[model samples]
Structure formats: structure tokens, C-alpha cells
Target: MTDSTPSLDLLLAGYVLNTLSQEEAALLEQYLAADPTLQERIDQLQATLEAAYATPEVKPPPQLRMAILAATEALPSQQTEALPSQQTEALPSQQTEALPSQQEAEPASWARRLPAWQLAFGLAAAIAIAWLGIDNYRLRLAKETAPTEIATETPASESLDYALQPVEADLTAAAQIELNPAELEGELTVAGLPPLPPEQVYVLWTILAPDAPFTADSKGAILTETFNTNAQGNVTESLVLPEAYQTLAQVAAIGITVESADAPQAHQGSPILLTDL
Candidate 1:
């Protein structure tokens, strides 16, 4: 509370609204005590504030009237519960005392139901704030996980899948590969094949015909791509098809050969895995 007239008016407004904390109220009280004119202004402001709240223009929810009545009915019972019988009896008589001057609550409401209306508003405000906080938190969580959800639901429609046919029999060591023909891209997934030596890389070849003459020194047949197997003889690898074949499925046969990686373009080893497109 300041000594100036404008500050006094603001202090009176806060006092009328019952919004001041104990420390602030104490400061205002001290200021008011020294000036009789300020005390008169406070009384006037309080009357105006009460009138404003009571007017038809300031309509509270109809439930608020019910809350006011309920609060008035429960006041005596709440006062009894505020001092538990067992706790009151346990406290030594000498320690019991009136509320100290500094700890004093605001003066009792002149209009008893006015405080009830104020209490109902406070409870409604607290509930609204809590609901808003929870809603914002949930929205934030959804935003953070949005990318992962979209990725999980997305279908890989651009890629074409080809099931490899084993040349000799229905072998379990064969790998399934998916290809995107437009990009000349391939992903080979190998499982159950015995892991070969690191020096021998697995080479995939695309041949022009089933019985086509082929060799490292030969022309026409091309080595599509090469990769190594993992510790479990399982490997999933991405490969690019040769420029001669935009789609590897266009070729007659696909074969995997255990060969030295030093000669990527040549086939110097016997075929270990053979399949048709």
C-alpha cells in the first residue's frame, strides 16, 4: 500500500474483492489506520463491489446458488470437522490460544451468502485450471509420438516383392528379396545359410538365359551386386541392379556365388544358391 491517493484506491479495490494475502492485507491495514479518509474510501468501494456482484448483469451459474445454500448449511459441520475431537483433546490446555494478530483471517463476510458464492467460484476456477493442464499434457504427448505412429501405419507400396524359386528343391536356406523395379533397387534377406569365410563374399548374378555360357572373362552375363553374410548366416542387404537391367526380374535366372570380393564384376566361383525370377 502506497501513500498516494491512486494507490489507496487500488488497495481499497483489492480489499473489497477479498484478494489480498495476509502480508499485503496487514500492510494495507497499517496504511488505513494512519488515514481516516482512506478508511472511508475503502467502505465506499466495498459497498460498490457488493452491488456489482449482486446485479442481474453479473449472472453466476444457477448451480452457484445451490452451492451457496449448501455451503451455509455445511458451515457448522465443517467447523466441527476442522477441529478433530481426538486431536483437540490431545493438545495441552496451555498451548490453546486465540488466532494471533498476525495470523488473523479476513473479517467475517457482512453478507453471509456472498462468501459462499466466492467459494463456489474459487472451486470452479481450480477445476477448470486442472482440466486445461491435463488436456495440454495429453496433446503434447500425442504430438511427440505422431511421427512414429505415421511410420508404423504407412505401407511400402512402391516396392515390388518377388518370391525366389529354389533350383534343386524347396530349400530352407534361400533368402527372400524385395525389389523396387522403378529405382532398380533390391533388398536381399538371407537366413539359414551357413556363414561363409569373410574373404568370400556372396555375389548375385543376373543371367540373360537359363543355360547361358558364363565366366569371369565372358560377356553378356552381369554380376548384379555382392554382400557378406552375418554371424548367424543371416543378412539383409540393399543392392542396385546393373545398368543393362533396370528390373532384375527381366533376366532369366538369379544366382548367388561364393566369390572373392576383389573381382566384383567377374564370376570366379561356383554357384552356392540358384533361383529363378
Candidate 2:
């Protein structure tokens, strides 16, 4: 709605905050009486405001209320005389006759008639309070309904299989790999290998059955994981496969490659030990 149009939202907000002029409050009450949607919105706002204040509330010190009351009493009174009461139609100085009073009188024109400064101050105060309440409500909600982090536990290995034996022409190594299908983890232990420079490491490669969304080289190869051997020329590692590569059952072959430390993720070196499933 345009700013010029009277807003049901403004009326609803003021009603919830108890700051509406009597006329606006009455109008809002009448609107809500007939509109369930509007009533729901107002109720939701009121519930949020209540939830924000309900918890983490501490009572003020015993004397705080009394002191505040005393201070307010001591202050000079501003003329509570309402703004020029709504214009009254002039009747004959002496009415020819009296009419019976009706059940309700038209409400006096409110806030619209207040001085400019009073209107501005009231608006500023209301905005500040509303912003504060909204911020607090959000913080409380975040604290109570935060996402929980789930932890994956390692599964027990069913068996350790010496799957691949390196050829003597390249380097002597014994490869025993433990498979934990439940956790999608593999523990690879390579012994009898000679460790030389710090800039080199062993890379494990696997050939998956060519039916997945995985990127492979011309030789249909995918890097499983990489590990650096310890100073004793031996390496043991528990490798974890990402969700996409967890299709271990679909792997056709497992192999090991000697890759330089600076080698790109795409494997170019040939396998030192390779064996088909």
C-alpha cells in the first residue's frame, strides 16, 4: 500500500505495543474481529514479543520501581490537556430540545493533532524499541535452534588383504590394505620400500567401473589418495574416500604410483604395483 493510505499494519503494530491512539486501537479491533488473517498476524507478532521477554528476565532491584515512581512524581507535569479537542459543530446557544445520548461517542482525533516534536519523538522511540525486540528475538531463536554437527565414526575392519605386490624391477614393497566398507575407509600399510628424498611420495590410484560421474584420465584412472612414507622407508595410512568416490565395490583395479611432490592431481606416472579385483 502507498504511504498515503491508512495502513492496517500500523494499526496492528500499535495495538500489540499498546501505543495506538484510542481511535486507531478501536479501528484495529474492529478490523481483526472480521478478518482471521489479520488476527493471525497480530497474534504471531504478540507471541514473538512475549517469547523475547519471557526468558532471561531479571527483576529490577527492590527500590528501583519505587525510586522511578518517586522521580516521576517529582517531575513537573506537562499539560496533559489533550490537543485541541476535535472541532465541535456549533449548536444553537440554547438547544430547542435535548436528545438522548447514544451508546458510544465518536473518538477524539488523536496523535495527528499532537505537536510535531511529540509525534517525532514517539515515532523514534517506537522504532528503536521494535528494532531491539526483533534483534533479541532472532538471537534467542538462533541460540535455541542451531544446526547440530554430526560426527562419523570409524568402522571396524573386517579383514586385511595383501592385494598388490610391487615388481622387483621398480622397487620392492609389500602392500596390505584393510577395508572398512561401513565407514568407507581403507588402511594401507606398505613395507619393504626404500625412502629417498623428501620431495617424493606414494600415490594410490584406482580404476572405477566406467559408469560414474567421476573424472578419469585416458587410462580410466582416478587418484584414491596420497601419502608420504615415514623416515624408515615405511608408510601406513587410513584413507578416507569422499562420498562420490565411495563406490569401492565398483573399482576394477587398485594400483600405486611414484609421484613427485609437485605433480599435478592428474596422474601421469605409471603404476609400480597394480592388481585387478
Candidate 3:
């Protein structure tokens, strides 16, 4: 039969979370198998759900798991009483006692229940909880594994000015710098560069030659007037020199310097950023 029902967001949510009945689930599965769009929607919903789960799991207190288990164990005894005969036979006395109170109080009601359906719902809930728990554990694990020195983009940009200005070394640690491939023929975008002091501004340098002690003056070529940042704090200018800088076999590295705004001078301030290009 053609599906005459309108697309239901809640139904889709139920399907992704595996809360649908077998018939409902089977219908959804069949529809998804035949419809690529529906399948994609389901995938997107699942990804979103997983991501949501990850956020909450990152710092779940130790008591959350115990609470979930406690709630699951508290399901109406009427709901769980009629466990399969085999389960009843195999269960220890302690285990039977620990079964939800509803199970004991409504044994007869449970005895008439269908094992498959009950098991399905139980399994679904268990799987959901497990997914949530594991996702949370993994998030916490990732946070723990991350290096402390790594600067995140959002946090670094909050208080900084984006105008053509000098930034301090303390602030540079939190500023991100971008390079357009078309504007600067270089690899690796340097993020989190701070501004220079009032009398000093930043100059981008290309080290075309590597001298013995590796002084900035020993570098063969200089990239000029190519540094710019926008209000949103993105680097819009090019620090790359002409094509000649690319041919030098011994180019040491790329370096940023603090210099007087209008003189043929080179004073080594704190290296704001550096990379081999």
C-alpha cells in the first residue's frame, strides 16, 4: 500500500531512537530502504542525535549512570512481571528480587505479554542509554587527550580588535591568522597571532637563504605590505613574496617581525608566528 500518511517528525524521531513498534519500525525501514531522501534525513537526524548526546556526555556526573539504571529498574512491575519461563527458571533469587517491583506485583499481566515486543522495547532503551553513555565517555576522553597549548578559534577572538593595528605577544597567543592561497603562495595558515607594541608593527618575512646562524637579515627576500585583517578577524592580505622566493633550494622558513612602521629596519621582536614554506 502507498503510504498515505504525512511525514511525521515525531515518528521519524522515534524511528531513529528505535522507540517504534515492530510494525512501525518495519514500515519505516522499508520506506527508508526505498527512499534515498528519507534515508538521508534519517542519517542526518541520527548524526544530530549523536552529536547532542556527545555534548551532554562530556561532563556527566558520576551519578547520572546510576540514576538511569535506577529509573530503568523502576519501570512499572506490571510491565515486567511476566518474564519468560526460561528467564524465570535461570534467574537467581536475588536477581528476581531485584527485578522491578511492577514485575512482581503484576506477574499474571506479564505472563500474557508477548516476549518479543517487550524485549524489543527493553533492548531499544538499553541501546539508547548505552549510546549516550559511550558518546559522553568518548567526549570526556577527547577533552582529556587534547594538548593544553592548542588555542581554539572562538575563545581567542572574543576581545581582540580586528583593525590594522599592533597586537601584543600575550594577545597573539589567542589571535588566529589566515592566508589566502591566491594572495600568499604558502602552506599552513597560522592562527592565533598577537599584535605588536605601539611603536612596533608586524612585518612578514620570507627566508630565501639560510645563513650559518640563521639571522633574519640573512634571509634573501622580503614580502611587503601584504598584511591585513577584517572586522571579523580574518587575515585578508598576502605575506607571500614573488615567484623567485619559491625557487631557492635553501629557504630556511617564513617569519613575522616587529618593526618601525616606515623604515628600512629589522628589529627581532618576539616571533609572533613561523612556519617552513
TM-score of each: 0.36, 0.39, 0.27
Question: C-alpha displacement of 120 in model 2, angstroms?
Answer: 87
Model 3, residue 84: what's the lDDT? 59
Q: In candidate 3, which residue ranges exceed 4 Å CA deviation?
A: 1-191, 196-198, 211-221, 224-234, 264-267
How do the residues 89-207 of candidate 3 rate in per-residue lDDT, one tens digit apiece?
Answer: 79999998777654223322322344545534444454556657677678688898675434452233222222222344454433233433223343323344544445555666655
Error of 3 at 215 (Å): 14
lDDT tens digits by residue: candidate 2, 1-277: 2222346655665677776775667766677667657877779878766764664643434554465454444332332343323322344435422422211232323444455555455454444445556667788787766533112232122433547867556666778776655566778887876774767777887677777567777777777788866667688888775444344546677788878878736576778787776
Q: Which of the two, 1 or 2, has more TM-score?
A: 2
Order of the predicted models by lDDT, top scorer first: 2, 1, 3
lDDT of 1 by residue, 1-277 (tens): 2456544554565677776656657767877778767877778766554544443333345665566566557655554454345765677776545433432332222222245455455445434444444555677899999988876654332575665545545556777777665577878888877777767788787666544444323634577778887777788888886543453434666677778767666677766676565
Model 3 weakest 10-residue run by lDDT: 156-165
Runs in model 1 lying further than 4 Å from the true structure: 1-158, 165-171, 209-219, 247-250
> Which segments of model 2 are wrong by more than 4 Å?
1-162, 168-170, 242-249
